[model samples]
Target chain A: MLQIMEGSHAVAEAVKLSRPQVVSAYPITPQTHIVERLAEIVADGELDADYICVESEFSALSSCLGASAAGSRVYSATTSQGLAFMAEVVFNVAGMRLPIVMTIANRSLGAPLSIWNDQQDSLFLRDSGWMQLYAEDAQEAMDLHFIAYKAAENHEVLLPAFVCFDGFILTHTFEPVDIPKQEEIDAYLPAFNPYQRLDAKDPISFGMYATPDYYQEFRYEINAAMTRAKKVLREAGAEFGEMFGRDYSGLVEEYRLDDADTAIVAMGSVCGTIKDAVDEMRDDGKKVGLLKLRSFRPFPYEDVRTALAGVSNVAVLEKNINIGSRMLGAVGLEVKDAVYKNGTPVYSYVGGLGGRDIRRKDVKMITEWAETGRNDCFFGLREEVL
Target chain B: MGIFLRELRIHGRGGQGSVTAAELIATAAFKSKIYSQAFPAFGVERRGAPVQAFVRFDDKKVRLRSQIYEPDYIIVQDSTLIGDVNVFGGMKKGGIAIINTEKEIEGVPDGVKLVKIDATSIALEILGLPIENTTLMGAFAAATGEIEIHALEESLRERFPGSLGDKNVAAAKKAYEIVKGGL
Candidate 1:
C-alpha cells in the first residue's frame, strides 16, 4: 500500500524489511532521522536486529564490520563529517570483503561548517571499493537499499555498498512510497548466507598483515569482485524489478535522450529538476535530454557510453567540485573518460554545493552552455559563466 | 507521469507547524491518489523565526526537488509575515491565498483571490492551543479542492491518534465548514 512518509523513514522501513541482524550507527544531521527511525524500530521490537549505540562513526562501522565477519548481516548509516570520520574503517570493511550495507545521506564536508546537501562526503571515498548507488528520489532511495543488500551480499560479489541519497533533498522530503510486506521482501531477498565467517572451529584472521608477496593480489582480487558486482547488481536489480515492478535494469536511466543534440548528465535529486527543465526545453524545440546515473562507483562506464553515444554534446552537472584541475568533478571526469572516444565534447558544470538549489532554469541554461561547447560553466551563478 | 501539477507554499514562524502543514496537506493529497510531495527550506529554525514549506500535487510522481518559486496557491499561517516575508511573491495570478487573520487585507493582485480566515481563533477554540496548521489544512482543502475534507481528516487522525486526533479533526471540520459556507 502507498503511504506518505519521509525518505529517511522509507529507508528505515526498507532496512527493517531487509532484516539486518545488526545495525550500528552514529547520528548526524540529514542522516539523523534514518538512524533515529531504525533505533525506534529496534527499540519497539518491530525488528529483531541488535542496535549498537556507538560513540562515533568510526566505532559504528567498526562494530558493523565485526558483526558482518561473525556471519551476521549488518547495516549502518552516516553523512558528511561522520563519514569522514569513518574513512579508515570504510576501506577496511571493503578490504576485508565484508558485505555490509550502509546509507549515505550525502552532505557537504565542512571547514565552512555546513550541515547541507552535497555529494562531497560520499565522493571522497570514491576509491574505497564500495559500490555507490545514487538515488533520484525517496522511492528510488528506499528501493536502492533492497538492491544494495542483494547485490552486496552476493557471494560472487562480496562487497559493501552505499545507498546514497541527497542529504536534505531526499532525506527530509515527504512523498508517497510503497513498502513491501516483510514476507514479500523475504521472498525476494532470502536470509543472508555467508560465504565465510568468524567461526571459532575454523579460525582464520581477517585483514591480517599481508606481506609484499601477497598484498598486491588481494587488491587484484578485490578489483575482480568489484567488476563482478556490476553484473551482480543487474541480476539483483532485475530480480527486484520482477518482484516489485520498478525495473532497475539500467545503470543509467535515460530521459528523452534519443536523437538529442545535448545530454545533461546528473546524479541524485537534482536530476528531477533537470527532467522538468528538459521537458520544457523539448517543447521549445531544444534537443536537450537527461542521463540520470543510478550507480556511480562501478562508474557505469559502458552504460553511460551507450546512452550518450548519439548526442552531439554532453554536460555533466554535479554537486561536488573537482579542485586543482577543471577536467571536471569526480563524475564528470569518469563520464568524459567513458564517452571521450566518441569525439563528443563533454562540458562540466559544478553547482549546488552546500545545499545550494539547482532550479529548472539552471538546467536549461546548462544545456545551452553544453551546446555551445562552453568551458568552466558554473551553474546557479551565470555571471561566472558569462 | 501525470501532466496536471499544482504547487502550494506555506509561510509561518518556527514551531508553528509550517512544515507539518505542508506534510499533512501532501499526505492528504496522496491519499486521494494524487502524486504529492512536500519539503521545507533547510534552515536552522528557531521559534518565531519565519520559515517556509512547500507542497506539490501532480498527476505523475513529483520529481522537482527545488523550492517552489511559482506556487498556484499559498497559506500564510501568520499574518505578521505578509510584509516581513514576501508571502505573496511568485504566486501565480488567479491563484488563491488563505491567510490566517481577521483584519481586511488589501492590494491583492488582479486575478488573485484572497480568503482571510481567523484560523488561530478557530484552532484555539477547538484544539485549546494556538497551533493552526490543522485548521489551515481544512481551509486549504475547501479553498483549492486539491484534496477532499475526508482525506484531510483521515491524514489528521492517522498522524495524531486518539483524542488529539479527534480535536484536530474537529478543528479542521469547523474551519472547513466555515470556508465552504463563505464560498
Candidate 2:
C-alpha cells in the first residue's frame, strides 16, 4: 500500500517483511531508525525474531555471524566506524559464505567526526567480498533489501550483501512509498533454506583455517561467486519486478542518455537531484543526462560502457574521494577505466562529502566543465574554509 | 498542479519537534493528494540549539533530495532564533512566513507576508507544554491554504493518540481558527 514514511522506517518495514530469525545491532551514534523499528517489531511480537543488543558493532556482526553459522537466516546493519570496527568479521562472513543481508545507512568515517551522508563508508569495504547495492530513494532502498537477500542466498552467489542508502539524506527523509504486502514479499523471497548449515546432528567446521595453498583458492571461489552474482541479482531483480511492477534488473539505469553529449554517472540519493538537474538542463538545450549505478560491486563495466557508448564526455559526480588517487572519486576511477576504450574523458567531480548540499546549478557547472576541457578536480572547495 | 513547486523551511531549536512538524505537514499534504517530502538539516540536536527542517510540495513526485536553500514559505518555531540564524534568508517574494510569536519580528524579508501567532501560548494552554509544532502547523495551513485543516488534523491525531492527541488537535485547530479569522 502507498503510505508516507521516514526512509529508515521504510527500510525497517521492508526488513520486517524479510522475516529474519535474528536481528542484531548496536545502538550508538548513527544507530539508525531501522534498528530501532526492527527492535520494536520484535518486542511487540509483530515479527517472530530474537533482537540481540550488543556492546559494539564488532559484537553486532560477530553475533550475526554466529547465528547465521548455526543455521538461521540472520540480519544486521551498521555504518562508518561501526562497519570499520566489524571489518574482520565483514570479510569472515563472506569467507564463511554467510548470506547475511545488512543495510548500510552510508555515512563518512571520522578523524574529524561527521554524522552525515557519504558513500565513503561502503566504498571502504569494497574489497570485503560483500556484494554492494546502492539505492537512490527510500522506495528503492526498501525494495533492494529483498533483492539483496534473494541474490546473496542464491546457490551460485552465496555471499553477504550491503544494501546502502545515504545516511541522513535517505534515512531520515519522509516520502511516499508503496510498501509490498507481506504475502507478496513472502512469495518473492521464500523461507531461508540454507545451502550449507551447521547443526548438532551434523557438526561442521566452517571457515576452517586454510594454509596459503587453500587460501588462494578461497579468494578465487569468492571472486567467482561475486562474478556470478551479476546474473543472480538480475534474475532476483527481474523476479522482483514481475511481482512488484518495479524493475531492478538492469545493473545501471540510463536516464535520458540516448544521444546525450554529456553524462553524469553517480549512485545513491544524489541521483534523484541529478535527474532534476538533467531535466532543467535539457530544457535549456543541453544534451545531458544521468547514468545511475545501482550495483557498485561486481562492477558492471560492460553495462557502464554500453550505457555511455557515445557521450561527448562524462562527469563522474560521487560523494567519496580516493585520498590521493590520480582520479579522486572512488567510482570515477573505475568509470574512467570503463570508458577508456572509447577515448571518453571522465572528469572526477567529487563533492557532497560530509553533507555538503549539491544544488542544481552545480550540476550545470560540472556539465560545462566536462564540455570545456576543464581539468578534473574536486568540483567545489571553500577557499575560506581551507 | 495546484502547487507546481513549493518549498518550506522550518526553523526551531533542537529537541523542539521542527523535524516532526515538517513531517506532519508533508503527511498532511500527502493525505490531500499532493506529493510532499520532508527532511532536516540537523546540527548536533542538543536542546536550545538552532536547527532547520524543510518540506517540498509539488503536483508531481518530489524527488529532489538536496536541502532547501530557497523556500517559498518559512515557518519559525521560535522568534528568538532569528538572531541565531537567518530564518527568512532565502524566502521568495510573495511567499509567506508563519512565525510562532506574540509580537511582530524585525527585518521581515522583502515582499514576504508574515503571519504571527502566539503558538507557544496556545500549545501551553491546551497541551501544557511549550511545544508549538502542532500549533504552527495549524497557522501554516491557515496562512498558506496549501493543506486542508482537516487533513492536518488527521495526521496530528494519528501521530499523537488519546487525550494528548486530542489536545494537540485542539491546539492546532485553535491556532487555525485564529489565523483563519485574522485573514
The most accurate candidate by lDDT is 1
Could you tell me how far off, in angstroms, the CA of residue A179 lies in candidate 2 after the best superposition?
Answer: 1.0
Off by over 4 Å in 1: A382-386, B1-3
Write the residue-wise lDDT of candidate 1 on A1-386 in tens digits.
Answer: 78889999999999999999999999999899999999999999999999999899999999999999999999999999999999999999999999999999999999899999999999999999899999998888988999999999899989999999999899999998988888889998889999999999999889999999999999999899988888989888898899999899788899999989999999999998998888889889998889999999888899999999999999999889888776758888989999989988888898999998888888888888888889955677647547
**Highest DockQ among the candidates is held by which one?**
1
**Candidate 1: tens digits of C-alpha lDDT, residues B16-35:** 99999999999999888899
lDDT of 2 at A84: 89
Model 2 C-alpha lDDT per residue in residues A1-386, reported as the tens digit of each score: 88999999999999999999999998644546889989889999999999999899999999999998887888899999899899999999999999999999998899799988789999999999999999999999999999999999888988999999998888889999999999999999999888879899988999999998789999999999999999999889999999999999998999989989999999998888899999898888889999999999989999999999989899989799898788888899899899889999998888988878888888888989999977667666898876
DockQ of each: 0.74, 0.67
Q: List chain B TM-scores, each candidate.
A: 0.97, 0.96
Q: What share of the true interface contacts does candidate 1 keep?
A: 0.82
Task: Write down the DockQ of candidate 2.
Answer: 0.67
Stretches of candidate 2 above 4 Å error?
B1-3
